[model samples]
Target: MTTLTRPLLVTLVDDYDVVLTGLAHMFDDYRDRILVSEIDANAVLHDAIDIVLYDSFAQPESDHEEIAELVANPQARHVVVYTWNFQPELVQAALDEGVHGYLSKTLPAKELVEALEAVAAGEVVVIEPKRRAASAAGLDWPGRREGITDRESEILALITQGKSNAEVATLTYLSPNTVKSYIRSVYRKIGAESRTQAVLWGVGHGFTPDHHRIDHWLGGP
Candidate 1:
């Protein structure tokens, strides 16, 4: 593991306790590169922190206000969104909101730490341009039900893509409780009793990826 002369003090902001715990474990191996000081969904900092890492598993746009709030906090000198949803417009919006970095969740742990270190040193970072471009092209879920809200549709799309509630919370910038509520609503609307059933229903109703774009999005040769 690579070590930094001064490890960045990082606080993770996510809606799920399990997600926070998992991230803490991932960073624990690189003690010399980064220190996981605090984890909370509200971006509260008990002590001075060098970096605030916001994990967006699926909902980047929805979390803009929270990101802006964290950026305005004096304790957060650097704010980065570590996300799987790489819509270019959303990334640009985050930058506009004063985010220091927007990085892909696909990045290896070491690379993520390095990105945080760079952000702490007063640099703006964005990883995986091609993926962001492909994402910007969009991942649409057709055949939506009549009453589902846009946010519900977005969460349903991610659910069909096989994301857990915790993952969904991270992606959508929603609290896990919020994610669960959305899921329940989606289930009632679609008549799904379980995740597997929802996924099956989504597939039957056109919750599918554009294969051509997916190939490019995954960096396939």
Candidate 2:
């Protein structure tokens, strides 16, 4: 008789419902290998999870307090960061926080599943995807439909959250000049001429962080 392995139980974390919903759909075809147990936003887990994949949408990166909190969760066997930024210092800091994985946002769904399996097996995985002009298919963010790239949308989200340019650079591991470039692009895309205007536009367009808990896929008890 042949033995069958059970799918790995995983939870997706992000501040936006759209972002987490898109991420959950990416694993639809790989249900045999990975089971999405929940889609949450800074909420505590009620059930045991093999991996907690924290999506760094608008939130601060590696050094953020939330990452440390997740690392200390007893229900989460392993904590991983799913982000677009992969500077060496950021990666090292995340590892130092006890994260099991630091994966790039550009990874294809299939590759992402493989990476999660590796993390579950106790391997420290850090994958920096090749430079790409766009995010992977099946992924969504706040301003994606408005012709904003994922990176630009992230900057807008941070700005909406009252992050200054210097703070944004620190959180994203981007240089000040690069951050300004992205801000300019976001301004053009959203028809905002000033930071105040951009922030107002962001506020009405789902850029503000959603603090309420969400169980998008698996209903909470």
Prediction 2 TM-score vs. true: 0.91
lDDT of 1 by residue, 114-140 (tens): 788878777899985444232211122
For each predicted model, how many residue pairs clash, with residues at least 3 apart or on different chains?
A: 7, 0
Poorly placed runs, candidate 2 (over 4 Å):
1-4, 39-41, 216-221
For candidate 2, the 10 contiguous residues with the lowest summed lDDT are 212-221
List per-prediction Cα lDDT, in the order shown: 0.67, 0.84
TM-score of 1: 0.59
Query: Which residue ranges in model 1 land beyond 4 Å of their true spot?
Result: 1-4, 58-60, 129-221
> Against the true structure, candidate 1 has what lDDT?
0.67
